[model samples]
Target: MAISKHIIITSLFISLLLLHPLVQAIDQEMTSNNRGGSSFAPKMNCGVACEARCRLSSRQNLCKRACGTCCSRCNCVPPGTSGNQELCPCYYTMTTHGGRRKCP
Candidate 1:
């Protein structure tokens, strides 16, 4: 009888442990859906400085700096332009150095 009680208690504890992660996952999903997915992105209102910050890593910032330099030196903008503003060429600037070149 004592063994059976111990087994039942252990089973309940194990089930709760397994379900805890699932419950947390559901809560996180709900919160993300309520918010705008992720808060990691930089606020657009900050303008140029913030734009440079978003491309934080050395390589990524390199591309950005290149764009700015290229624009000034050539006095010609890339394909996309909103009047005088230079557009982000890469899809997402890459911080990882060894990966393929970033998308524009």
Candidate 2:
């Protein structure tokens, strides 16, 4: 049992060491991609963006409420009242407390 435990620890250490460079590269790429998540996207008017996004929703108020929250956080709103989440990865990934997609 001790030998197996030792082997496991050694393997885990080796794995993390080998993966360190890969982790650093990923971190660097993401940092560059969003500049540490500060002002990376162009300044946008959340009111206008959410208005456009929620314009066609049957439940306009709820749509705008959720869209407003998403816009403030992601600094983006998908064009139109429907799909196009690809334009904003952050918005695409936003979720509610219930784990459902939040943006309209």
- Per-model RMSD to reference: 12.9, 10.9
What is candidate 2's CA lDDT for residue 51? Answer: 86
- Over 4 Å off in model 1, which ranges? 37-104
Instruction: Please list all clashing residue pairs in model 2, or write none if there are none.
Output: none
Q: List model 1 lDDT by residue over 1-104, tens digit each.
A: 99999999999999999999999999998888668523544333323543444354456565556455443333333343222233442323432356853322
Clashing pairs in 1: 89-104, 90-103, 90-104
Misplaced by over 4 Å in model 2 are: 1-37
**Cα miss at 21, model 2 (Å)?**
21
In candidate 2, what are the lDDT values of residues 1-104, reduced to their tens digit? Answer: 99999999999999999999999999989888886557565778999988888888899999999999988888888887799998999999988889999888
Candidate 2 Cα deviation (angstroms), residue 6: 58
lDDT of 2 at 5: 100
The 10-residue segment of model 1 with minimum total lDDT is 75-84
Top model number, TM-score: 2
TM-score of every model versus the real structure: 0.35, 0.61
lDDT of each: 0.50, 0.89
